[model samples]
Target: MNRPPLDRCTDGLPLPPGDDLDSVGPFVIRCVYALPRDGTDRRLGEDGTISRSLSAMQAWFAAQTGARLRFADEPVRTVRLPETDARIADRGSYVRDRIERLSRRQGFHEPRTLYAVWYDGSSTISCGGGAWPPELRGRVAALYLQGAYDDVVCAEDRFSPDGVAPEINEFKMLHEILHTMGFVPPGAPHHTRAGHVGDNHNDLMYAGDPPWNPSVIDPYHQDYFRTGRTDIPDLARSSFLDPLPAGAEPPPVW
Candidate 1:
C-alpha cells in the first residue's frame, strides 16, 4: 500500500551526522529497501517510514549503550534484487542466504558497513535474519516484509503514535542488526545455545518460544551491551556505534 504524505516526527530528533555518503566512518549501518524484480516498490524510503523508524531505533540504542548507531544518512537507500519475488520465496527458510544477494553489490558490500535491509519479498515467517559475529561471511541483516508491510512498515498505523515503530518493526530490525554486530557473544552468561539470550523471553535478543515482548536491551547487562567483561565482544564498543565511546575498539573487519 502506498503511504499518504507523511507528517512524521522526523524533525527535532537527535540524528547523527548525515551526508548521504555510502561510507564515511570506520563503521556504518546503512538502511536499504530492497525489492525483487516482480515486487511492487512501496517507496518506504521516500515516505519517511524508514528514516523515522531508524531514528527511533537510535533513541532506543542510546538508552542501551549510551551511544547512537551511525546511520549513513536520511532517505534510506533502495536497491533491486537480482531475483524475482517468487524465486526468493522458494528459499524462504534460508532467508539469509537469499537476502545475502545484496552483498554482491559493490556499494552494499563495503567491509565496514552493515546493511539493515527491508526486503519487499516473501518468506516462511515474518522473517528477519542476522549473521552471528563469528559467521562474518556477510554483513547484512534483512527482514522479509512482503506480507507484513502494513503490519511492519506502516508501523505507526499498527502501533504507537507519530509513525515510530521502535517497539516492533524497528525493534526487530535492531535485534537483527545487533546480531550482525556481534552482540550476545557466544560466551555471554545467558547466551542461548548460540546467538541470543535465553534468560528472559522479554529480552531483545531472546530466541525462545515465549512472546517477544521486547522492552529493553540486554536487561541484565551481563550479556552484550556493557557487561564490562573483556573476554566476549561488547556492543558498546562496536565501531558501528556513532560518537564512539572513549577508546572504543572496532569489531573485526566484517
Candidate 2:
C-alpha cells in the first residue's frame, strides 16, 4: 500500500523531525531507569547491556534517518516511584508523573529527549492483558508518551531470563521510541487507525513483540519524517496525562 502524507491527527500538531533534524552535537536521549520497590531480577539497567543496546539503537536511527543518537556514558539513574496499578490508564500517568518528578529532582539538560523506563518485576501472562476499554490492555509492555515524544513507559515483562535476549529488550525500547517520533506507517491502515505498526509482523514497529535482531525502520516511517509531515496521530494531545505543570523545567533544545 502507498503511504499517505501524514493527515491522521484531527488536531493540529507538529510532527517531530527525522531527516530535517540537524544537531550541533549528536542528539542524545537520556534514559532513566526507575526500579520498583519490590523489584525482581530484571537487569535492564546493567552498564554493558544498556550501553550496547543504546549503541545498537543509535546506529539504527542514524542509518535510517541520518540522525545521530549519542548515548550517555554515565550509569543509568536508579530511581524509586510510588507503586501504581499496571493497567494502561494508571500506567500512563504513573510513567509521566515519575518522569516529572525525576526531572524536578535531577534538573533538566539541553536538547530535550528524555525517557524514563519504570521497571516492575515480571509478567505472568504470556498473552496480552486488558479488559474494559480494550485500548488499555497489555500496552504496558512499552508506550511512547503520546504528545511529548520524549518519555516512555517500559513495562516489566519486556525481558525474560529463559527466552528473551538482551538485544530483544533493546529492540522493544527502540520500537516505542519510534512511535513517539511519529513512525506510524500510513501504508498500514490498522496501524494508522489503531496506533500500531501492524501491517507487517517483520517490521520493528510491529504491533506485537518482534524478533530479537530487530528490523529496519519501515519505509513509511522514513517517508513521514523525510517529507517532514506534521499531522501524525502520535503528535496529538494525550488523552492520558495532564499537561506539564507550572514551574516545570522546559525541555532542552539543540
Candidate 3:
C-alpha cells in the first residue's frame, strides 16, 4: 500500500500486542468528549451532567488501568486509520475501520474486542446510539463516548432537590465505557429496563434511565485493568498491556 510509514502514521504509542502485521499498523485509542456547543449550565448537579460524570469515570479508569487519558472537545467527524492511504469516511465507519486495522495488526486472532458508540443530542430522548461495525464482532477492545446526553440538573430544579453527586457521574461513565470494552460479553440477553442489574441492567445498553448503581464496579470492570483482558486483543499479552507479568514494571499512572 502507498501509505505513510506505520510509525509516522501512529500517535507514538507502542504497537499494541496482537498487532504483528505491518500493513495493519499500530493501535490507537482516541476519545471524543462532546459537550453542548451552547455551554452547559454551570449549576447542574454532578450526576445530572455528562461532563462531570465522564471526568469521574475517566479518573476511575485511569486509577485502575494506568492508561493515560486524553479528551477531545470537537465534534466526531471521522477517524483516519493507520497505514491506509484513505481515511475512514464516516464516524461509524471510521470507528469500525480503526478496530479492524488494529485487530489485524495486533493479531486479535479471535476478534475479541467489541466496539460500541453512543451520542447524546438535545432533549431527554436517548434516541441516538449505535453499535460498532458488524465486521468487528469480537475484537472490540475499547469504547468511545461521542456526545452529551442531557442537561445537568441543579438542586434548585424541582426534580432534583440535591445536587448531582460525583459517584453518580462515575457510575454513568463506567456503564458506557463497559459497553465499549465489551464487558457485557457476547450473546447475553438484553434487559427491558434501566440501571445496573447485577450482571444485567435496565440501563443504557437497554435504553434505561441514569443514576446507575455504584456496585456495578466489579470483576467485569476489574479484569480489564488488572488482567489486561480489557485491552485490545493483540496487545493483551504484551508487557505494555499486562501490569504484573514476570519481571515487568508497571506503567506510570497520571
Candidate 4:
C-alpha cells in the first residue's frame, strides 16, 4: 500500500473551509497590483480593470464548482514596486513577499491571501500565460496584461462599467485559478473514455481552442476533491514519459 514520494498537501482545495475536512467555504483573494520592471511610471486603473477581472473570475468559479471564491471588496492594496521576474521560477517568491507585506499592513494574522497580480506587461513572460498555483511555494494566481489598464476594461471610447473587458480573454484567468485549486494536469486520471481531458473540448483545462464559458469541472476533478487526493501535480516542472511513436496507442494512465 505504498504511494508516490510527492508531498501530501492538507490544504482544502477545489473547496475551502478546511475546518470539517470537507467543508466548503469562501476562499479569500487578496488582490495585489504590480507593474513590469520598466513600467513603473504608468498609473494602474485598479478600480476599473483589476476589479472587473477579479469579479469575472469569481463568477466563473462559482458557476463551475459551486464554491464561493471571495476577495477584498475594493482595490485598496497594491504593490509599491514592480515584481521582479514574475514569469520565471522565482515568481512565487516575488508574489509571496508582496502578500506578506500586504498582510502586515492589514494587521491580520492569518488571512488566506492568494496574490492576484494585475500585471502591466506582456504575456511573453511565461511564454503564453498561466497561474502559479499555491502548491508551488510562495506562488498564487495572477492575471497578465500586455497593455495598460484600459486594455482590460475599456470600451469603444472610454472605460466600461459592464464587466471584464479583457484584451486577450477571460479563459487565461480562469485556467490559472483552476490550477491554484489543485486541478489535475492535462492527462489521465482527468480524461474521459474517449481520451478527452477536461470533460470535453469545452473544458477549461483543454489543451487548445474553445472559449472559456460553457466549460466546467467534470466528475474526474470531483473525484480528486471527494476522495481527499491532494497530490496536485506541478505541471511547470513535472516529469513525464517519452512520447509515443506515430499511430501508436497513448501511454497508460499514470
Best by TM-score: 1
lDDT of 3 by residue, 10-31 (tens): 2233333432232232222233
Model 1 residue 100 distance off true place after TM-score fit, in angstroms: 2.0
The predicted structure with the larger TM-score, 1 or 3, is 1
Q: Which candidate is the best by lDDT?
A: 1
Q: lDDT, candidate 3, residue 156? A: 19
- Stretch of 10 with least lDDT, candidate 3: 1-10
Q: So what's the TM-score on candidate 1?
A: 0.81
lDDT of 4 by residue, 131-216 (tens): 22233322344554542232332112122244534222355555544444444433346543221243355555554234234345
For residues 76-189, write the lDDT of model 1, one tens digit per residue: 888888778877766645566566653454356664677898877776444567766554334678766753333543323231235444747777788878777776787898
By lDDT: ranked, best first: 1, 4, 2, 3
TM-scores of all candidate predictions against the true structure: 0.81, 0.50, 0.35, 0.51
Deviation of model 2 at 49, angstroms: 2.2
Our tally of clashes for model 4 stands at 0
Q: Over all chains combined, what TM-score does candidate 4 have?
A: 0.51
TM-score-best of 1 and 4: 1
